[model samples]
Target: MQLTPTLLAEATRRGLLSTEQGQALWDFLAEQEREQQHDTPSFKAAHILYYLGGLIAIGAMTLFMTIGWEQFGGTGLLLISLVYGTAALLLTEYLFERKHLALPAGLTAVLAVVMVPLAVYGAQHAIGLWSDGDARHTAYRDFHYYIDWRWLVMEFATLAAGAVALWRYRLPFLVLPVAVTLWYMSMDLTPLLLGGDNLGFFSDLGKLISLWFGVAMTLLAFWVDLRSRHTKDFAFWLYIFGVLTFWGALSSMDSGSEWGKLAYCAINLLMIAIGAALSRRVFAVFGGLGIAGYLGHLSYTVFKDSLMFPLALTAIGLAVVAIGIYWQRHEAAIGRSLRRILPAPMRELVEQRRG
Candidate 1:
């Protein structure tokens, strides 16, 4: 009838008791079970103090932020508070690395809140609301435009920094979102450059550079995940979705005649095929989009000119036949080449699946 070690361990894991407290409780219960005594207290006060301390700490920090100490030092107090909060959050993370405390998430949230007020204040100081007579009005306008350029630069810098930081911190989860954000910003700037608005062709060039960087970042993310022993998680799926959406949108925006469109479509298809061959999830997602897009185009073509439908069908049939013949002749050589290029583990997987 004595309490078992397994029960004691389960209680600790469930947080009903700390390990030390659980051990003591188990010993007491075992003694009582042996002696037929039932006088011992069933609960301990230590657990209550542990939770109470956490609640007090949270409440104290909340009160400190809510109380208006701004009158004493104005902006200085706010800045000091921000710095102190950031430092404390970082320190807590460093001290409690094993707890999964989500300190990074909290720090990001707090920084965002601090930035909101700073952004509004800077905007107001730069430009008066709806008043042209204010000298600051012109200055604000300039500031606004300046901000656009500043943002472009900052976004690029952030993209690079995020890549390096991801590698340094070994947090592949962050790289894709940051890359996507930078890509989005670059896309927004693309129209301005295309319209000859004088952000310069350099801006267009920068956008193209960002586009390629985004592609590289995405591939790197996949490669890292594939090589990693960790389970594929939310971040991996997010990158796949983002890459597909971004690339699909880009393909739709491409302007060209039938031949040009055909070429673009072929390139997209090749990209997908390569992705599938590599077994990269992001590539597979994009490949699916390419397939959908191709089918949609074929449907549009057939509906627009029913007579062309037969010719299109014949062309597709011939293409498929030709590809099948080529694959039959070259599949072995291609497989060997791929195995040489891939890592040892991945190469073995590829070899095992060769058709």
Candidate 2:
């Protein structure tokens, strides 16, 4: 299916295409390839470096922040965060407009979005929003490691700033920070929704809320996936975080009965079917993990003493492998058939490229 220069030359020699027509076709195809390379993420060394550098910079300001940063105090921290955010924005504009570097520009924009929470935290600290003895008052690092209702203000600010950055840049990478902040919000909102800090995150109410939130986030990602038409995928990060949130919460919940566990396996199988229909590997990955966990449970508990257990498992494994090979061989036909079962409007959505 790949068109090459040799193929074009052969066509020209065979009189299938005139020399001028072949040259024009080659030029158009080459330009399209160039654009695709520029806009899409790949494992190319330069692209890897771009993401690596950006992630390190973002982690430095957020995940890897130190307690030493607290020495600056409220007003000083606020000023420093403002300065850093402004500089990142200026760099984003320069890279995007003057240098024509989309990847680097998007990274800088993400950096700016990441700074919003820090800035919000600083502003809150300056205004004495944190009481003197509170743990959250002492370090910004708790934003990631701990769950508290107090972090809601910063999370909301980050979401708003991320929206602005996405609007300004129209870059797919801008969705990364936004998706992450939404995940954080899902956790933090639990304490507030349950009406007290007395119940920690592991409480039953918190888990149920997280499960519901994950469903909402996944539906949002689906809507975005259907609408996106850009060269780069904008819903990829959203789908990843959404599925992780949902699956993690669902898996962590206690399923006491045999029937309940069987239902879990069935749900995971449905997830696999959905993944095939949507062409999203994220669903397939989590669904496969869920199914594997169920199998492991059966191995250790239900069939542990049975003599035929090992043989049965081996047969199932081989069957799965054979099915995978068959699936790969007829993947295009299977995908087409799956698409046909969807509604007309949703069929179009299914045809869109997935991350």
Candidate 3:
């Protein structure tokens, strides 16, 4: 469905548009796409450096915090965070206004939002609201690795700050922090929801929550993609975290029965199908890994002594590859046939893209 130079030239020849008009339209759109490519963070060297340097600075401020950093009184830490956040915000303003760099501006703004959790932590510590018993002695890195209900305050504050930054900037890069905060919240909220009463129960419940939150995030990503067709990818972060949480939670489940394992495999395959439909490779990746894990388990446990199992699996893989080639060759015809087989309303749904 994409309009390319060839399509435009063909259209001009077919009298859909005058030659001049066709060329003009193509040129305009080509320029726009080029500009967007330059501005948006991607695999380009400049963009990579922008994000790498920004992440390094951000990591220094948060993730790489030393025990010595905690020696600074809570008030001092809070003041320092405030100073850093203010500087980041000022840079964001300068970039947006003078430099016209949306991606860099959003990254700068995320730096500010990134400081929120630390600032909130300091403020909480300054008051008598330090984290749970053992968490009080835990390093800042533990905030990421471990879930404590006390961390909810920091997560909420970070999410709010990220929301404000995104609202003010309208930049896609800002979604990273928000998506991350949501992921953290998804884990942290588990303890509170379950009242942190039983360790084993909490672990299982947290995984369930992670799976559902991922599902919700994935659905939301689809909604965003549908609404923002032909624009920069605003749903990329959502898709990433969604797939991570969903696949992580699903993979962690200890399926006892063969039926349970088969169901798990089926869900992963469904994820692959969904990925193909949506053109989101994250879904395919997670699904592929999940299926691989399942297959490995079967190989090591159920079929350890069965040489035929590996042969059968190899044959299945070859069949899939052959099917893929056939699909590639006649995708349009196959799609038409599938749609024709559907009810009228369903056919319309299949034929239509987001718009």
Candidate 4:
């Protein structure tokens, strides 16, 4: 995708363009890169270290938290969280708004928003309010391991903080924490919505809810992608969370009928096709896993006693490899034909992604 000097030279040598035209194209691309370098951030050591240090701090205080952190008492924890969040916000203002350091600034903003859960948890503890029953003495680390409807408090607070940060800073990376909180919220809400029943955590009812919510989130991500084409990419994390949630739910189904299992395989194949058309490889990755799961079922169940199964599977694998090679050689032509079949609006979206 990068236009390099050697690539220009090769194009000229192949008579694809004259030397002057090739040079002009290279210079134009280089100029665009230079103008965008600040927003995009370079892959240099200093930038890498900057982001790494920020992420370590963020992760230590959030995901890597231990029960000992709660020993400071609720008020102390609340004060500490507030102090850390304020410092991050100030740094974000300086680095992102004033210095135009988009990547690091966005990470700092994320860190600030991620502190909201700690603050909320501390406040709840201070107020003597426990979301779950008889969990007044529950360890803080258990919040992550156990899914309780009570954790909805922290999830909602985190989501709110993330949304405010994004609205104020217009940073695409801030969407990650928001999306994560939303996913957690979906899981935690399962008990509340379908409670008083025997359906446990990650049961079929919860999976169905997660699947439908994931579908909604995926559609929302597509909408954001369309709108943010000229700005920083905001839909990437949404798409990631959506795909993970949807695929996790789909893969966990325990259907007993052969037609149902085959239907699952068909849906996974459809996902792969859609992913290819949209150029989003996440769908392909999940779809491939689903297909593999189905194949595994066949090997372990339907074809368990048959010697021909292994040979047939090997032949299928070889055929797939051949198809991949052929597609790699003719990708450009295939892309053109695919575009022709797409509706006008979808064609425009695909062209934008190509750019």
Query: Which one is best on lDDT?
Result: 2
Q: Write the per-residue lDDT of candidate 4 for residues 76-148, one digit (tens) a residue.
A: 8889999999999999999987997878899999999988888888888778674335634455566666667
Q: What is the C-alpha lDDT of each candidate?
A: 0.50, 0.87, 0.82, 0.84
TM-score of each candidate structure, all chains considered together: 0.46, 0.92, 0.87, 0.85
Model 3, position 7: C-alpha lDDT score: 93
TM-score: model 4 vs. ground truth? 0.85
Worst 10 residues of 3 by lDDT: 346-355
* C-alpha lDDT of residue 12 in model 2: 100
**Model 3 TM-score?**
0.87
Q: Model 1, poorest ten-residue lDDT window?
A: 138-147
Candidate 1, TM-score vs. the true structure?
Answer: 0.46
Cα RMSD, each candidate: 14.3, 2.2, 3.5, 4.0
Which residue segments of model 1 deviate by more than 4 Å?
1-96, 100-147, 153-169, 184-249, 253-255, 307-355
Largest TM-score belongs to which candidate? 2
Least accurate stretch of 10 residues (summed lDDT) in model 2? 130-139
Deviating ranges (above 4 Å) for candidate 2: 9-21, 135-138, 325-333, 352-355
How would you encode candidate 3's per-residue C-alpha lDDT over 163-208 as one tens digit per residue?
Answer: 8887788888888988988888888788788876343223877788
lDDT by residue for model 1 (1-355), tens: 4457987798799999998999888888778564332211123363344335543543343333432432323345446545654564464455335453332432333332223222332333334332436433223123223313333443454455455434434433344436444444644465455553444214535435445545765665556545552332224533564465446445644445777667667767776776667555566667667666766787787356688776887798799899989988998787677679888776754443342
**How many steric clashes between backbone atoms does each model show?**
0, 0, 0, 0
Q: What is the clash count of model 3? A: 0
